[model samples]
Target: MESEMIVIHAENAPMPGISKPGPHQRYRHPVISVEKRRLGALHADEIRVQMIYAGLCGTDVHLMESDPQTGYIRSSAPANIPETGRVIGHEGIGKVLAVGKNVRHLSEGAVVTFESIIVCHYCDVCRKGQFNQCRNAKLLGLEKDGIFGKVVDVPAMLAHDVTPIIQTDQDLQAIACVEPAGVAYVACRNTRVTGGDVVVIFGGGPIGVFAAMLCKTIFGASSVSIVEPVSFRRSFAAQWADHVYDVEAFFANMPECIDVVIEASGDLQNINRIFRNVNANGRIALLARSGTSLVLDAMDHMITNAISIIGSRGHLCGAFNDIISLYKQGRLPLHQVVTHILDGTDGFMRLVGAIDSVLYENCKVLIRFASANGRS
Candidate 1:
């Protein structure tokens, strides 16, 4: 028997008495609606997944705020409202509810984590194995419906099997973080971290912490440090980074001849600070998506120091597989970064309303859609 599904579509509607000078406009509420529909058959290469846990990201908070500078929210709608009103989330781990006839590697009831971006294999970048920079990329949450809802239809290739890493449902929940971990891995790859090098990460957010973990655990950095402003995040970062410093404290005793620097804060001031600290020929990887711009000191940093500034975007989807393998080997401690888990739909709304405030204190927040016994 076919199951029933609810498909929420957002219509074009602007708030009253609000006009924006820039391209971004403030929307008072989250743009989501629930509509009734029957579960449709999957495409030959697609799979139907029932979401178990969806992680709330900083990007979601920016979307809720209608932050004019955030990438996904600013581009969410032509004006202020979304066209599809699709469920809003990009990071999740789910169980395969059904698989299409042509789906070869996956089976119903199998647990998986999906890569949020579905790239066109025909693109030049994708052909060269740089799918992260694919010319034509269709994002799951932004360009299409996301995985926040009960069930989602995803390309079978985008879903990676997590059975190897997941020992219990709790481990499956941690898989919701594989996306950010992959992004951090890409940033570390950009910096070309080597053993015994000193690495510094700016910001104490989930990405910042995960980048620090990869630098220490995978790249074998001699020392990993974090520069964060918030006391709560600074304390949380201590578990992963060897040294956690408040911004002022870090600047006071800033290390010299740093091997690699990762700027994940999205704060423009970090660039200048990087210039002062990074050694000649050291690599600095910019990993933030905050729609902010920066002006670099060319003479002192670029020409004289010969510092290489690498702009890193999303991860190669295949990187998720590597992350899962590492997690299975007990190298990636994703669960350590999960600070809170809110259960059910009401919990989801509560997060949407208070996410901006929570970002200062929490590392990663997961919304548990299913109970421990697998009931929703």
Candidate 2:
């Protein structure tokens, strides 16, 4: 019974907009369980994966209780749930218990993780190696079943062998965080950030905090300044930035010019602030995923100072390797950034609640999951 695996199902889940209060216990109420099996060839090109830890994302929160059904779930799932089961969660790290016959780049017992966006090779973007921007992208947990399940069958192409990453296997769940860090890595690379550049970072969330940390560590910026109103996240920024302040203080202290601005909070209002705070010629690297309509002043933003804002997508290929190298080389101190770790049982709900608390409190949190099966 120790290795027993099971599949839990959700027949009906209300739209995130309609779900009251939170995401964990709502939307038909998801359940976590286990079953015992050979764990091979569960689906075509699907290799069974034993999930160790999966982080609950802010997007999951928006899908859980926020208004307007947008994001991954709204894009893939039926607005109403008389339709089919909904499996949610994308930032998951686990071990492969077995592999399908056709599987390559991975094998049974390999530790692995992957991005959620699955692109059809036939798409024009995929054909051009811009799969991240593919029009036909199908998100994993959003479009189909996600990695929240104890044992999942993942496409081999997406699952990179992460076993070599475990410097010490004792802390398996901490390694799961590589996915979010990978996100930060990809965002920072969008522009040429280097030493002596004055930068402003908005949205003291995990992404924003990492952006500040990376800008400090990798780029050696002359002065990395972060603008966030939250206390906890502001502290995270404090550890890295030469100057960290609330929105008001950030404006009061800054000149009318910054070299680069990284915005992690999805609030459209932040855009106006970035435009106001940065120098005439500057770069704006945005990591936020926005949904609501945003109004822009074309003349002020585009024509005058000639500012450039680049929208950051998910990880690029080789990004995970780059993040790992940073960690190994002591460039990124990922351990200090982890503020909270919750269990897999109620991880999603708990994490969503924490994110909301941090929005007000200003800190970062991650979910950590481990098996009852003793470490091998």
Candidate 3:
């Protein structure tokens, strides 16, 4: 269990002269309250983290506004309001408060970020070396309460230390982005992107921009273009993508054939359009999430063009280490992806706004839970 200090209100009580609220109270110390975990665990391989920053994902937004009647979120636990009914956020970066005795490489006070998908390594799929396809997978924020609160306990294998690569405050802010970058890396790997190949990504969102960057930096693609209707997002994407075009402009000025197409927007229409745009022997990686299904001409478009359609769901565990190494080497421009930073108080509302899709032009929104001094 974790505890939080709360200042008591009383008449004639002296205020503290501390710089931050936690340990430096000059007068009476704040009261400590026990934090409850929805799912109980302190496994030998688990580590407890005191979350300092958490990034808001599109999926977080989906859960916020999902209709109860339709049941868009399918999970064993209540996604909307888990055990504590507190704020829920998945993409997180924090300090290791405690590590179980069996944990080897990690220690207390280490700055780290973790993978959201908790995979059961002993499962049949995991035994096949396909951990991403684990039959009994539970997502952090989806199946249980997430790291929106001040503390979270997660499996040590999912945690990666960011202290070596994160030098400045900006670098620390970008740690939350590493997870999504890994997602894009997996998408590009699924498409079998190679050097000197032309890539077109649909969606100028964070994942799309990250995919574009990964194509040029990691995959060594010859050129990359992004298709998005939002001018703000297009301009932001232009900083990384070789070319940025709106949906109509993408259709008007598209190349005769695209070597690779990555669908990251989850827009049904954009997904269907990939069939006519991909070149012969090209590959399409679908990384989008949508409620509606898209119909495509499989025989005429896929078979005739020899285009391989693949769906990429989650990132491989090693991808995080790879992306962090690249970032440390100054190869990836991850810091440029975060456009908005919010105080922890407004994280839930801002995440809801980000999910609306049309309401906000967000690349990445981060929630600052506590400062370096431990003040909220």
lDDT of each: 0.75, 0.64, 0.72
lDDT of 2 at 96: 86
Which model scores highest in TM-score? 1
Which residue runs of candidate 1 sit more than 4 Å off their true CA positions? 1-38, 67-81, 371-373
lDDT of 1 by residue, 1-376 (tens): 2332222233333444756422233333345434443457678889988778888776665555544343224332212235545556778898888899999999988888888777899988888988888888877665666677666777887888885666786697678899988989989998999898889899899999999999988989999999999899999899888899998898888788788989888786777766767877889888776655677765556677788889887867467878888888888878888888887566766665565656776989887776434578
lDDT of 3: 0.72
Write the candidate numbers in order of decreasing TM-score.
1, 3, 2
lDDT minimum window of 10 residues, candidate 3: 23-32
Better of 1 and 3 by TM-score: 1
| Tens digits of per-residue lDDT for model 3, 1-376 | 5433111111212235635421111112112122444435667888987777788776655444433553233111223232234335568788887898899999997889878778888999999988777888877765545677666777787888887775677788777788888899999988989997999999888899999999987888998999988888998889888899999998888887789999887776775766687789999887877554677865577787788888887876478888888888889878788888877645544444445542256778777877544566
Model 1: number of clashes? 2
Q: Please state every model's RMSD to the true fold in angstroms.
A: 4.1, 5.4, 11.5
